[model samples]
Target: MAQPYADTIACIRKSTAEMRDLQRGAMDLDAPGTEARLEQTVRELQARVDEQQAALEQLRSSSHVDIQQVAYASGNPRDKLKQLRAVTAAYTGLTTVAPFLPSKDSMLPALLAARALQQNIRGTKQAIASAEAQITANGALLKQEESNLHDANLIEKALRDRTVRLEAQIEDRSQKAPAQLAKELIAAKRAEKKRHDEETQRLGDALNDFVDNYLSAMLAAEELGGPVVGDMLNVENETLAAGFTKKGKAKATKKLVSGKTRQRRIDQIWGSKIAVEEEEEAPLTEAEAADAEMRELIGILFKTLTGPGGGRAYHQLERDSAASRFLIRAKIAQFHPKDAQKLRLIDFGRELDD
Candidate 1:
């Protein structure tokens, strides 16, 4: 029921629209404000570099202080060492100076100060270098984006012209008389319904097969004394675990309050059914939790199948090898919030040897 090129056409349309926006400089990347933002970033980085440079100059001035003269000026040994330590610590960024300390016998406060100043100067230069590199990278990216915007405009225009001509030709060739058109419409509707029915049946069969496999796996795990056997076996039956009865054909009946008539809502908009009232129940056990998760996943799959454009997507997945085995498994894992990482293709009973 789906056209083979539906996704491709949709992609082209989206790309063209984005290209049009880009050419108009309406997108964030190409907007007039983007340039202003870049300029602001450059100004901020430059200001930081200037601030660090000033700090560096102050540190250099402090490093040039005559520590040796200060230490010699102190007569007491203890006083000399204390002065040396004080002088070294007073230098900016030199408080973290380790492996170099003023001892009672020999104190080299000047060398400690010089090492700290060297580290600070190196760090300041590195920061400046990083900022400059980022600015250069940003300029290059902006140029590339601008060039791409021009190219995208050309491509978008060409594609629009081609698609318009092709669509016109298709429309001209597809015209039919009223009577014949009505007849063809009936046949097409029937065919599409048949396809839908077949896919639904297939999904139901897959669900049943999946339940069997799950039961089988649980049994096997039980035999092997696996860790989760108790949790898996806690549910009364596979039907209960799946939250539906086989005879009901996946329709779940809920008890309703007396004299009340109401429709029950399922997970999504398309899952409305007859319902009654709720009854108080105990909290879910580990087994019930797992069963609830499986029911939710099944509901999602059915919802996607019945949703708008879902038939086309499912048709693609059925026909395309790239979509069938790998993609279906991926979708299952993605939709399943719990045990996603633990899920395998075989668990769904869909993918075979190939």
Candidate 2:
């Protein structure tokens, strides 16, 4: 059961695989590879098509046996045998033949030879019938496979065309990436130098300008602290409001970093002495220096308070810990005792009540 063009389609699949691999950026599909791969695929496909065509030609040649051979092999079984006997008798000259008559001794051998020839013909016909039946059973599947191959070929062609276009894109990106980066750098430098004039007749507008640049710089350098937004306020919208803190001073965060990014930013500004024998080459920004000092202070406090032979988890030192009486005074309370007790959960809180 041979499908037409099966091998040709298989070759196309190989080309498709090559195209897919090229897409994965394995080979750039540059000038030499493109032409060579395309030629190789074409050669293979042509070879397969040619080979299948030859096989089909052979099948056709064998199928077209002489009609006369099949014709005599047809008709009723007994009648055909009688006819065959008649023909065989004439062959041995047992019946009237021009100037010839066969003897009984010659007739027997001649008849045996004729019978053998008839049996051979019958076997050949039966073999041809079996072959036809097998062909009929498998022929549909072969044709179906060929049809699917055609669809796959079409998809493969699309993939090839798309690949050609994509190769151009890869080339374009390779050419433009550096130039584009330079362009972005120039734009960034220009933006850095461009400053908005903070001087305005309105004091509110002037202060807002400082807030804008301060936030911008804080974002650029995370060590630079900002106004404590959303603390003791109705919502984030009340960040600009006053009287939140008694001294109106915004509270700073505990210097705990939230993610690797902020930690890296801190490290970049304040180089790590922990990782090197000598100090890092770069000088620290003032904010960075302050943060480093605070970090050192916290480290010392932690080691003294809670490391081995320590008396505290430092739990009692906290403002609301149950062991508040263990400390002489609490320096970390959010408010004066009278007002602070008002914000307690219930029963004036166990810490304050105790």
Candidate 3:
């Protein structure tokens, strides 16, 4: 019987424990090197981007033009070249006058340098783009990781709430077993008590009727000599035993009763097989057997509550005139937690007194 309850409690605890582990797992999604590795990757990518941009800027600003290279403008070469030199001489902070055209020696070097700077700018821009692309890709991954963490948090909370509910339900049911059983026991005991009280009253009434009839019959026999109903059951009148007082003659202070009458009444009742007025029901049937089994169960419940120290405590509850009946019905006339962490019985006897 209790095995089912035990199994349910165990299962609930196991589930809660697993949920607790899952909660930890949710929080630990980014354990050890996960966050650190992501941070390092982002930082390195960004640094490479900064370095490439700086290099590109330096290449763009490097000296790519000289008088020789400016001589190669798109126009009539000699006129355009002299015009460029005059403008360069005015604009440039140089001590000497500018050359109208460049010798072959300087022209080749300047042309090569200009081409090299252009190539460096293109390559550096590509490097910057590549570094930025890596960062962007990793950034999106990090955003996904954050989204996953948010989902994990919600999932963990939902699981925790479920675990809490299961815990409450399991404990409630576990405690309800004993609590419900205790209620049944109380009801059974009350019924037994009421039945016994009724039976006692019935027997008492029957005895009174029997005594009245016997006395009346005895009186009628003494008067008219008609019945033998009281012939064997004569109760002698109580008699005084004489004794001397301190001053003089003997006198009776108390009356003495005879045992003969009592003995006769017992014999008459026993010999006649007189029974209570209630019709006796035959036993040893299915209903009686079931009743006997229920009685056994009730006895076990009794022992579980009041038989030993530290059993279920029956609290004498406080009463409310307005809500006493409601409180009793709600099992709060005297109440305790409906869980095994605390177990007690609530008795309404005090409230009944109130």
Residue pairs with backbone overlap in model 3: none
TM-score of 3: 0.21
Error of 1 at 285 (Å): 20
Q: Candidate 3: lDDT of 241?
A: 17
Q: List the pairs of residues colliding in candidate 2.
A: none
* Minimal lDDT window, size 10, model 3: 235-244
Q: Which ten residues in a row have the lowest lDDT in candidate 2?
A: 235-244
Taking the tens digit of each residue's C-alpha lDDT, what string does model 1 give over 42-139? 56657767987998788768897664566464888897788877766777456565642334322234335546655765665566566557666777
lDDT (0 to 1) per candidate: 0.48, 0.46, 0.48
Report the lDDT tens digits of candidate 2 across residue range 119-206: 7656655665665576666788788889999999999999999999999877976778787968977997777665322222365455
Give candidates' CA RMSD values in order. Answer: 28.1, 30.9, 30.6
User: Cα miss at 255, model 3 (Å)?
Assistant: 99
TM-score of each: 0.26, 0.20, 0.21
**Which has the better TM-score: candidate 1, or candidate 2?**
1
Q: Which digits, one per residue and each the tens of the lDDT, describe model 3 over residues 31-54? A: 554456545555665776798799
